[model samples]
Target chain A: MNITLKQAEKIIAVAKEKSIEIDTKMNIAVVDAGANLVAFARMDGAWLGSLDISIKKAKTARYFDMNTGIIGELSQPGGPLFNIEHSNNGLITFPGGVPIKNAAGEIIGAIGVSGSSVENDHTVAEAGALAI
Target chain B: MNITLKQAEKIIAVAKEKSIEIDTKMNIAVVDAGANLVAFARMDGAWLGSLDISIKKAKTARYFDMNTGIIGELSQPGGPLFNIEHSNNGLITFPGGVPIKNAAGEIIGAIGVSGSSVENDHTVAEAGALAI
Candidate 1:
């Protein structure tokens, strides 16, 4: 199923709450099952540079069906997925991207966060995805 | 000021209503002032190929602050902007893209619509932008 605007807002709201909790502004993005952007938000003071990164992270997670941090680990210089990130016209494999699943355990979409450290980004992304 | 998720949803809703009035399915995209994606929707049965085009159209409109149809006219051979479509890594220099302005007349975002005739796409895009 595609992500409705309502669901997308829910994800963004959770991301915002998590960002506030961590005291870091963030750029949050949500993409549909087809990896098309569904919703996005750039918190005040969020880094402009990371806006597109948030979108790409969600795309990367959807494209591979895994968290970007895990993808980063697998894409290391001689690893199995070496150079895989380059395949999708550039991927942010470090962290902060997570696939979103429905109650049936089907992947419905994905959430991506940026404008913070990799660890914090991942945490925010996780909060959003789980809120779905 | 950025285009929040709430505003994006309002644009999408108006576009959907216009698409129905015109008897066509459509892919709609919205982007903030910085030309980054804010929200996107592909109505059921919309053409798959026009998905990314809708996003790019919004970006094109935001980049030049003009409707894509006007850009298309200027990009015609022998025109001042002939070949300009190829300048921004490929732009949709046709109809269906419009800049979105706030109540104060400040451009805050843009809307793009596709998956129908050029005329109908432009009509739908206009409806969305005006809804803002």
Candidate 2:
């Protein structure tokens, strides 16, 4: 199933709310199952450098069908997925990306958040993905 | 000026309306001046393979400050821009991508359309780019 624009907006809103609650700005990106951008928001005062990182994070989650934090751990040196961060042009194998799943437990899309500490980014991204 | 999510949604709406009027499914993509994806939509039944092409087209337009069709012509063998398409990780040097400009005529971003015939793609992309 495809991720509708309304759903994407809902995810962004949830993530933005969380970011504000934590007193941090964020660049949020939502991508469809095919890893194409569906919606994005760069909050006021968000770092410009994190703009693409948000998208890449979402893409990495979708591509691997798991959260980026898990991937990061797996891609550590001597790990089974070592050097995977260098794949797919470049992926953000960090904590800010989370897979979006439907009631059927099928992955539909992913949400990525950046512009804060990795832990905070992950928190915001988790809020968004869970909202879906 | 950066293309806000609201502005990108407006552009996509215009393009989708035009696509409906022409009875064609489309993959529409928008990118900021930095040639990074900001928003994208793949209408139901749009060719899946055109997904990446749509993003690439928008990047090509932003990179060259012109339409992809114009770039196609200039990049022809023996043309001054010969082999230019290969420069930017492979540009789509054809119709369907247009630069997005502000009131002062400064390009702010770009829009790209695919899934329909090249002519129809260009028409829809132009409609979106003109909306701003």
Compare the candidates by lDDT and give the number of the best one.
2
Which ranges of candidate 1 are over 4 A from the true structure? A1-6, B1-9, B20-24, B77-80
In model 1, state the lDDT of residue B99: 96
Estimate, for each residue in A15-102, the C-alpha lDDT of model 2 and write its tens digit: 9899999999898989888887776777755888998899999999999899999999998989999999888889999899999988
Per-model TM-score (chain A alone): 0.96, 0.97
The TM-score between candidate 1 and the true structure equals 0.83
TM-score of each: 0.83, 0.84
Measured against the native two-chain assembly using Cα atoms, what DockQ does each of the candidate structures obtain, in the order listed?
A: 0.32, 0.28
Clash number by candidate, in order: 0, 0
Residue-level lDDT of model 1, residues A1-132, one tens digit each, is 777657877888899899999999898988889987766777766888888899899999999899999999998998999988777778989899999998889998899999999999999999999996
Candidate 1: what is its chain A TM-score?
0.96
Error of 2 at A80 (Å): 5.1
Model 2 pairs in collision: none
